[model samples]
Target chain A: MVKDDMANLMKKIPIESVTLGIGDVARATGVAQSKLRYWESKGYIKNHAVTDKSNRKFTYKTVLQVQLIKSFLADGYTLTSAVARAQKRAIYLDALRSFFEDRFAQMDVADHTATIDLGPFDPTPSKHLMAKRTDQQWRFYLATPES
Target chain B: MVKDDMANLMKKIPIESVTLGIGDVARATGVAQSKLRYWESKGYIKNHAVTDKSNRKFTYKTVLQVQLIKSFLADGYTLTSAVARAQKRAIYLDALRSFFEDRFAQMDVADHTATIDLGPFDPTPSKHLMAKRTDQQWRFYLATPES
Candidate 1:
């Protein structure tokens, strides 16, 4: 039971400490290695150096940053604006992460329908905050265990 | 039915064009308007000018950006590094948004179990990718409509 709980918790939160080389990040994101270095030099992205200062290593987070900048650049934004826009989008992601970590208790599916159990309601702990979807429609309700 | 589809889609995607005044943003994010203006001047963030250049209105996206920067600053990151870190996080959010938009088919709950129906598998379109949770354990499987 303890192992299962740990696994469930680990699955919800991203591992931020995983580091990759600049080459690996460039390959994953499709951004050139030179461009990645330039962004780091410009203070738009960062690299984690282990022991040696010349060796560039980036966390999984930095790879995502590169992808975002590339996406904004593809959408015709200036480099400066792209970085700014990416920063803005990051905040929304933070909220989503928090929601998943805090409220996402469980998920179940039956007959093509999916139910996301958002744990218990704050005002009414006896009822769960359930988000249900059937076909393309989504509905939310507070319901007891029996219901 | 068409109106319902539109509403559903709109609910899934965030409205990016909603603009707020600097004061409103400051009040919402608890970051001073002066700091926001300074960040703008430094090209760390942006504002939309409706008719005049001096009248600054920011999109809902920018408001989120301010909050992210403030959070990172609280975490003891330098302003430049904080913005960079925020940009990295934004990429993860973009991927999450895409997943919710493209694959999230439905959700259902019964007997305290929640299921998330992730539409259909690309390799096997007839089977849906269902993620279910009962108690603290999560399980994933592919199932047909009848099953």
Candidate 2:
């Protein structure tokens, strides 16, 4: 029964179902092949099937990560900074999806469709506050709670 | 009293705080001056004082917006898309800041630091979802609620 349950869980999770080529990833993510290669060289991204320097295969998830990194770069972050943000975002997204999956699985058994309070999406204000506010803004808040 | 409050509110906000030249904006944001000029020309960003083609003054907010746009562009979005995202982010950030101010104002009167449930940090998943999921992922969720 445990074996069956494990198999079922594996099936539910998107566990390495499809593989994509570098070209496919570039096309899917709207990122140029040259940039993709550059990112790989810079260690910002990795190719799973690094059979050769010229030929490589990547998972769909890698494509997603590349897209995330690209979007960050587009927003004006340095390549290094973008990569860091992408990595952190990936972890956060994975946690959110896992939470959703676990909750959805339980909800299926009960057949209930009520709003689930996924408490405190992000607790840290600094993490979400992409822009660093000036000291004045902070002082204003501190000085005048009524304002 | 009302006029004084309005004046105080404007003063507290980062409205017309500091003006920066194109060079300063570029240096501060790590964006090219040429790109900043281009963005301004294209109406994506604004300069507070446009004296001539060569000389312009932008607010600190403009510098931040330019940085945001540049990051978006690096992420592989079209220039137009990046601009749109930057605009949306500006609006969202303002709303978030206002919410924080209101909450902080109330908390000051209460003298409490309890966990204020600012529910649904991300109401729109599409805006926040860095990677666009294929239909397969959605179908999986729909088909296998039990999983």
Candidate 3:
């Protein structure tokens, strides 16, 4: 019955189970207490209620939102910029995912583990050119298909 | 054959493949061009040695390294801290991987996933709480776990 009844509400965070203090939040999110206070002061989050002698109980949604925000901040977003473009959350996330994929690919210990686009060559520049053109002292940036 | 022949050398950076003008590095990393030039002047990175007549080229490696530094900066780090803690090539790549992992995780629609963990509950009030308790809001900081 618990499973059947709860299944209906599973799509949303349950309000009753949403009672966690700072310690619980810290354990769940791996964030520090001092930093959470700073986030509250900066208005990155708002609590739904403060009861049972003024202890802050965070909702599940707040936890996920905080996680997303933390990820963006980690990916080189300014707090102000992150706030302003909060709705376009996907962009920063994409950058983060691509980074992970590249790392995982590198972990593959196989001959074809490298994932690079050497470009669509005309088939004339043989492996010899690949060697000679690779000037050890020079630096070059290859363009991504989109960039 | 080319890939096989250079398997040993693959671990070494293809420094020649990095490409960035100071301006590009600035824009991509959100650092000022003057700062980029200053960092280079300070020997964080060096330009290629050239014949008397030379065209400037920057490798993608430098750009990616700069991106890694920028990620650390966004995570509330200073240039000094980043250089000290994240200078190892593996560290840079790990930062990139973690960033991307988060982004990828967000992409999954997560179709109403729910999990529950339940255990024993002691309803008895603790004797340790015999003293008076304060009512002001207890503030704390928390960040989601690293991806």
Candidate 4:
């Protein structure tokens, strides 16, 4: 009885750092296995090898990529454009990160008051900033400074 | 003959404010008529008029909205989320407009030098300012002043 209980307890424990199988990824992302395979074939995603032939694994990031591809397809984008846009989304996010990282260093907070110094406003840059206040108010600003 | 030529000229001229038919919108936006009709039925879009029983008209804004929706969907957002995101996009653009409008009033430009006083930076706010120098340099600052 003690041995049986130990085995059951071990079975109940999941590996927290799991590399998901194809089926697991499909179920978690609401995407089809066939589509995931196609994306892999097209170089949109990479598959983790689990065995010699039948079992394939995927990381959580690949699962997210597959889910994003499905959403793009449903939104009427062609496969190539969707992939390109997905890449562009990453670049945009990186730019946003850098933008915030630089600005966060200059922020000052005391009590309910906060202040920011926007260096310069650009007329031709594509992305702009939106400022949100704690009281639910917000504002926007251009990111470019004239030289 | 002159009167006939004048009439033909008038016929060739397009009215600036004309509402677009489904086919016209489809051709202009590169979206299929079927998808446009489906989006309309799904409440992701609205028809300007339901003329007769079959003819549907869309406003110019709807054409722009469809393009935006297509782009968002291509970016891996769900239909519902895409619509919501598109609306947010409009609000963000409006906020950007207001941000620049207010800041532009404070701008001093002379030769290769420009100065803008965005006041102070705040740490507690959700939005912050990212400043980029046109010479490929960048910085970030909070957009709030301490009280």
Candidate 5:
């Protein structure tokens, strides 16, 4: 089970399976259901396909995208431009996620200090990268597996 | 000068002074001049205030935002959603930049191997973080300043 959990953590989360209804998306994002529907119609957002046409479901990613779009709109971007900005942000979010998934190895806490193992450095099988956080400061270093 | 350069490296790059013309932004981002103007007029994007209204100028940040917006548009998001996405992505990019600025200490290369110093570990002034790269693999470890 632990191995299975580790394998699951290593892979990208299947976003398709975790879904929410339109109402939930609206509430979570503070976007009106009608506005979400309109954005979907215009291809500004997407929803999962369902057997019933009236039953609209969206992924958590869409929820985040909607929140971003709403924030951008509030920041004075026109609706059209806000959506564009949101889509572009998705790329960065994806990159951050990938970095976490690929590099994050293990974390240990002792005596209130936390050590984060960032996994192996590329091309060097003998060394691994790690960071220690103490009182809000992070220090990075390299260590062998035995250490 | 080396010290000055290191100080500058530790700080965030001042982006306000780096300005470009609308034409340059359009050329770089593949966005139309008229469209950019429209976005500016709608407050979708901001430009540096110029003395002459006819002479429009944008900052480098604006240039990146425009490029992101354009890319999102190509990805099928509505213009508004794309702009929103771009704004959200800016936050992530900022974080990445901050991480590099705060954590990256120095890099040394010799014998086809590169060592990246990530600065001192918190609370433990005696230890510092370092990563060695050889043949694409990275190994992280802790070392005292003498080492």
Candidate 6:
């Protein structure tokens, strides 16, 4: 009974839905595994967990974060901007979930506005905010109150 | 007498300012000859006339344009974004000159008003009009009216 209780508690621990190994991330991002390692060395990003007694494990969140970094670098952001402001720089995309969630909410508002008779001043922000990674590039809409 | 008149006209035809050359451009911009060549290859800029056939000469305008491209790329404008919609994109730093010029003109007006002690609402623009780049990524500024 005591052994079963311990196993049950371990199962209840929260786990991120998506897990990717370094090789998987390399394939998804079109970046070499060695380059990913280099980015990690540069403090751009890190894997989800380091339990890799043999190789590292990356989560989906980290994968997205790397994608962002790649786009920013290619766009010509210095490493500092590519890293985002120090406070906003999260190692995992999960850490960035709230921000992206807010972005999605903004997108919803834009989508809703698209169908409405919201007048000329009510512009759709979706077209404005572009997200990319070679160097940190973001074009986001600043929501203006309906005129 | 006709030949002498023609010679005088030729002499008066504006000595061409040495057509400024690649070596002069390298000296003026502190950009390596190779980097400038690479930038030209990358389509950031072009030189219209290359006289002195074997050595290759560039106009002073070409030199300035190269420096401008370097500044924009250094400041994080992606090559694609910078070149978007145009054969050659203008430098981002050029925007600074216009922004500041407007600010200075506004200060002159504000100064005159402060001396006369006019009410705040009397000499102000309604609903702030901002002239900005519609296509390029924007940086917002609170533009006051020029005095």
Top candidate on TM-score is 5
Q: Estimate each model's TM-score.
A: 0.43, 0.33, 0.28, 0.31, 0.46, 0.27
Q: Higher TM-score: candidate 3 or 5?
A: 5
Candidate 3 chain A: worst-modelled 10 consecutive residues by lDDT: A127-136
- Candidate 4 per-residue lDDT, tens place, A1-147, comes to 001111121122211112455665665566788988888888887766645684666654455456556667879999987776555333222232233333432232333323333333333334333343334333444443323
Tens digits of per-residue lDDT, candidate 3, A4-105, equal 111112112222233445554554566687877777778776654445467565543455445555655778998766554443432332222232232222
* Consecutive 10-residue window with the lowest summed lDDT within model 6 chain A: A1-10
Cα distance off (Å), candidate 1, residue B18: 32
| Poorly placed runs, candidate 5 (over 4 Å) | A1-147, B1-13, B50-54, B109-114, B122-125, B133-139
* Candidates in descending DockQ order: 5, 4, 1, 2, 3, 6
Instruction: Report the lDDT tens digits of candidate 1 across residue range B1-147.
Output: 001121133242243433445765675577898999999889887767556655676644565567677878999999999898655444333333434665555555444455656666444668765656556454555678655
Worst 10 residues of 2 chain B by lDDT: B106-115
Task: Encode model 6's per-residue lDDT on B1-147: one tens digit a residue.
Answer: 001111122122211222444554665566789976776677665654434354455543455455555555667887555444122322211222222222212111111111111112111333232322123222222234346
Supply the DockQ value of model 5: 0.05
The residue-by-residue lDDT of candidate 3 on B30-111, one tens digit each, is: 5677766666676665564234375333333455455555666778988877654434542323332322222122221112
Residues B1-147, candidate 4: write the lDDT tens digits.
001111121122211123546765675566899999998998878776634575677654566567667777889999888787655433322332233333322222223322333333233344333343233345334444323
Stretches off by above 4 angstroms in model 2 are A1-13, A50-54, A106-147, B1-147
Candidate fnat values, all: 0.00, 0.00, 0.00, 0.03, 0.10, 0.00
In candidate 4, position A119 carries an lDDT of 32
C-alpha lDDT score of every prediction, in listed order: 0.59, 0.45, 0.37, 0.48, 0.60, 0.38
Instruction: Give model 4's TM-score for chain A to 2 decimal places.
Output: 0.47
Please report how far candidate 4 places residue A116 from its true position, in Å.
Answer: 19
lDDT of 2 by residue, A38-73 (tens): 888887787665346545655545665776788778
Q: For residue A55, give model 2's deviation from the true position in Å.
A: 3.5
Question: In candidate 1, residue A119 scores what lDDT?
Answer: 67
